[model samples]
Target: MSSIKAIVDQKLILEKMEGKGGWTFARVPKTTANTGKSYGWKNLKGTVDGFKVECSLMPLNKEYWFMPVKAEIRKMVGKQAGDYIQVLLYAEIQELHTPEDFLLCLQDDPQAFEHYRKLPDDEKQKYIDWIFATVDEELQVQRMADAIDRLSRNEKLPKKVLSAGKPA
Candidate 1:
């Protein structure tokens, strides 16, 4: 139930329930610096700490809308083109809530108004959350079903392999 403080005016705040199991956000992979050698060695590393949930503002009809956006979930790992990643929804404000109502109030006369305007549009579409199911206790039930299917197929999998990996 930990919540991050965000500006209600300049950004939109949204939440997705981690349910009883909780969740982790992932970081996008970064390109490596050139070594200036003929051997082209590209670095490919995955980061667990890079994932985060953020609120962003999007311009709509001369106004702005706040939406919750998720970044860096493990489900997106090794995703290829045309592949789909699953996301789970938590919660959001149905109506506009002003900055004054934010738990962490906007700083007193916080920076120039233009600063807010210069902010980037990183908000995700509203419907994206509709596609993902919550990462809940039910995941164990689903895993058990998958394991049973694998076992029936005569695949020699180690016991509890499905639950060994990270949870989204």
Candidate 2:
């Protein structure tokens, strides 16, 4: 994947969306986009404030793009809006493999699969990551089952919960 590194010496502006206010982002300059086209820009993997991240750049007018400076990142770097920052970004690979057991469970439960399929990519990644965090096969199976139950009911998984088998 294509990558870029640059210092962000601009202030982070707060923008409003859907009645909620949020921090604005530094933009991906056109020069960055040119390198990313061969790799696709829908999602990028990189670091901000030295923390690893995978995010999609928000497309702007005239082929320009931007990425939000999330609060978690702000806290990690110990800097707020208006602070100069550094960023390193590369196009994230498009191929994401879902576990076979999880896929089978989803196939057997159409309602759960429907809800799972409708989730935003990041949310889906959360569930997938949680389920795979451990190496225990039995635990992974149990987690997949629990995930199916939650999705079937259109319930969001609690952040603190790992699975029916164990605590995070």
Candidate 3:
């Protein structure tokens, strides 16, 4: 069972859900639990007991909501199920901008464009971010080309890389 009350102003919510193992890392405090409305999703940022995080506030079942905290975060925080930890968050919203060069490259291949469009906004943003996360223009160009090629092949990265536990 998960229990949390991540208090943000009205727009962001903090609630608990019924996930069997989600709550052990931290519980949203009960003091700010009863925020009036429920929304499908909200981007959240900040710390859960001073461990930095970027996560989502989302609904799980019919009656409640939860934050799906990552295992790495749980390990870093050194908390477990049934443990109580402080929750602090800020509602986050960001606009993703897909570079024109990427779009044009996609447009050159109908299948690639379709696959790219099918990707979630966050995934697309991550790809864009990764492509630009460098000072070497040559590497950035290579990554961009690789991204388009992989999309054309209907995959985020090559199968060999994934099978080898390597990230593209």
Deviation (Å) of 118 in candidate 1: 36
lDDT per residue for candidate 3 within 40-86, as digits (tens), equals 66566777668888876566555544666666876787765555556
Local error of candidate 3 at residue 23 (angstroms): 12
Off by over 4 Å in 1: 1-52, 55-76, 94-168
Off by over 4 Å in 3: 1-90, 158-168
Q: Write the per-residue lDDT of candidate 2 for residues 1-168, one digit (tens) a residue.
A: 322443222333433234357545666655555432423345666777578877676666555566777777777777665666667766533445677778888989999999999886667877898888889988888888888999999988886684542533
Which of the two candidates, 2 or 3, achieves a greater lDDT against the reference?
2
Q: Name the best candidate (by lDDT).
A: 2
Candidate 3 whole-model C-alpha lDDT, 0 to 1: 0.63
**Candidate 1 TM-score versus the reference:** 0.16
Pairs of residues at least 3 apart in sequence or in different chains that clash in candidate 2: none
Local error of candidate 2 at 134, Å? 1.2
Clashing pairs in 3: 4-28, 5-28, 24-80, 24-81
TM-score of 3: 0.46
lDDT of 1 by residue, 1-168 (tens): 233222221111223436764322221111111111222222222222233333222322222222223333434344322333332222232332223212122222233222322332211111112112235546534533433343334333342442343222
TM-score of each: 0.16, 0.47, 0.46
Q: Which residue pairs of candidate 1 clash?
A: 12-66, 16-90, 17-90, 25-51, 26-51, 26-72, 87-132
User: 1 or 2: which has the higher TM-score?
Assistant: 2
Q: Give Cα-based local distance difference scores for all models.
A: 0.27, 0.67, 0.63
